[model samples]
Target chain A: MLTKRIIPCLDIKNGRTVKGVNFVDLRDAGDPVELAAIYAAEGADELVFLDITATVEKRKTLIELVKRVAAEINIPFTVGGGISSIADVSALLNAGADKISINSSAVMRPELVSELAGEFGSQCVVVAIDSRFVEGEHIVHVSGGRIATERRTLLWAKEVEERGAGEILLTSMDHDGTKAGFANELTAKVSGSVSIPVIASGGAGNQEHFLDSFTIGLADAALAASIFHFKEVSIPDLKNYLKGYNIPVRIEK
Target chain B: MSVVIVDYNAGNVQSVTYALERLGVSPVLSADPEVIRSADRVIFPGVGEASTAMRFLKERKLDEVIKDLKQPVFGVCLGLQLMCAHSEENNTDCLGIFDVQVKKFEPTLKVPQMGWNNLEHTTGPLFKGIEADSYVYYVHSYYAETSEYTIATTDYVNTFSAALNKDNFYALQAHPEKSGKVGERILQNFLDIK
Candidate 1:
């Protein structure tokens, strides 16, 4: 049976894990390698490390941080943010990262997704889409959910899938940081539209919210930040809650 | 000593490298004939269109080098397809190491067969201790038609060769690296085979 994944996303900046509200106003979380090991031990199926800084100085540091984390952690990790070319994807994958997530760069050059998928296997490629509800329509946003694209979320998701994205990480900008719950409706819509696995991101405050994302949204995985980072909800506790709810999860020995 | 993973422009080499590392072996990714011949073992993993992959191998003259390798060799997914005499995918010619042809699975059974499927009829050192009917990960539309080379079989819509073995040459239609513990065990078994 396929296990539903529980992932804790960490934003790395200046070689440290940081968290922010709405992708701004960052505060220190912890060392990425330490946080990653904690999550893996707690039964997280995987981890995603996004380099939040856009400047050149921090980019080099972030790549080095990715190398360190990849070296230490045994579980699958995905590195994203500012990934522009096949070389970037290769660098992360070579560093022991299991997958690479592309956002702004992917939207700008959709062909890169296909090219990377061709070179590496599709399972190594993940496309992260930041979407916000604009006038009752889900519009795609890039550059950390700041710039809105003309493309609709669902349409772009279909395009990415056809381009050979192994999985879709759909983050609802509208619900991000709200802690109200996941955008179940949007996740369900995208999951239904794409043949590949869809991972629901944003708006998780509690264990029940995770369940809602799995049951209502039909998401294959649920990713969150502060809730897991702040220890407001431990991954084992959350998995226990989900197991009580009968959601399939891999229990660690 | 580093294991050599042939880079013939096929996919899944990264996963194989990671899997080997998990089993405490570091592999060197290479396409050069000398590098491959000098390594402890050679892994020929593949993904993507069979015809295009074969063309890449032929262009690099890796086709002949791979056929003459004296060390143990392993193939996965499209790698298995290419080892066969022919493939239904793009009607391409292959290495013909094993007298078998890769055929496309029935369209009605979901073209890709993308998920966990059970392995049956297991018989090989590669599957040594792996329980029968254990699920291994798979993703592809074409499969190797049953032949004397086949050592294991699986069923999606119908039974087909899940694994093939002939002397030092071994190929798996499913990805053992991505298949979790069962996959890791299979890989360990492959490494243990002397």
Candidate 2:
């Protein structure tokens, strides 16, 4: 049985973790490597390091960070944010990142999805779609969700899958940071529509919200940032809760 | 112990090398026939399309070297698929180290079947201290069917070979490097094989 995955997403900037992590034992909360190791030990099925660093040497810093994290953390991690070319993805994968997520680049040139899948295989490509429900229709947003695009969320999701994306990371701008719950209705529609695995991101406030993402949203995996970083919900406890619900989460032995 | 990961333009070799490092063993990545053949343990790691990987392996003559290795040669993911007799992917012929056929999963569920899945009927040195419910990470569209070489099985779209062992060769369909503590222990056990 393939168990539902629980992922901890960390925002990386300048080769360091951007968001303030609240892990007590962490020596340097800014150190993404140490933070990644902690999360891996605590039963994080996977990790996503979204690099928000923008500079001339951004690629160098990200590759170095990826090498360090890969050497320390045993679980698979995905590196995303500003990854626009095959050269960038090649360097990161060579540095030992298991998967790479692409956003605006895919929207700007959708051919990139097919090219990446053809060159590196679809298993390594993850297409992240930031979406918001606008005027009774879900619209795709780019540039960290600050700008809206005419591409419909569901249409883009299907297109990426057809273009050979291995997975879809769908984040809802409406529910993010609300701590209310996930956009289950929208997530469900995408998950049901796409054949590839869908990872529901954003709006994860509580353990139940995580459960809802799986049960109601039909997400294969659920990703959260602040909840796991702030110790609001422990992974083991959440897995246990999901297991009690017969959700088939991975149990540590 | 000289552990060398056979790199034939396949992905995930770095992760496998780092996984060995975590167990206090530093592994060298090499496509050189001498380095791979002379190593005490040769780790064959791969992640990519079958035919493309096969082409590269043949180009470097690593396929012949791998097929002739007497030392413990462990294959991961696509490496495992390439060890078989034939792959439905690209209709390519493999090294025939393991007498099995690699077939694509029916779209009853997800095509790639990505996520963590537990191993069952694990019965080899690679699974020495691994518990029954130990979950390992996997990402692939195709799987090798269970055969006499199968040492372990996992269920997703169907029951497939999670791990395979035949004489000096051992292989795993899942990414042990990314499977956390249980996976680390499995890698350690493979290194401990004598």
Name the best candidate (by TM-score): 2
**Residue A160 displacement in candidate 1 (angstroms):** 2.6
Query: What residue runs in model 2 are displaced by over 4 Å at the alpha carbon?
Result: none
Q: What RMSD, rounded to one decimal, does every model reach?
A: 4.7, 1.1
Candidate 2 recovers what fraction of true contacts?
0.91
Clashing pairs in 1: none
Model 2 per-residue lDDT tens digits across residues B1-194: 99999878887688998889989998988899998989999998888888989999999888899999999988999989999999999899999999899999999998898999999999978999888968999998899999998999999889999999999899999998999998898888888888
Per-residue error for A33 in candidate 1, Å, reads 3.1
Predicted candidate 1 versus true structure: per-residue lDDT over A1-253, tens digit per residue: 3457888998887777774423222233457787777676677777888887768666778767766765556566788888888877777776657688999888999998899888886877899999999987999999889999998999999999999898899999999999999999999999888877889999999989999999999998899988887777889999889989998676643
Query: Number of the top candidate by lDDT?
Result: 2
lDDT of 2 by residue, A15-106 (tens): 99986689889899899999888888889999999999888576588888999999999899999999999998888898999899999999
Q: Enumerate clash totals for all models, in the order shown.
A: 0, 0
Q: Report the lDDT of model 1 for residue B41.
A: 86
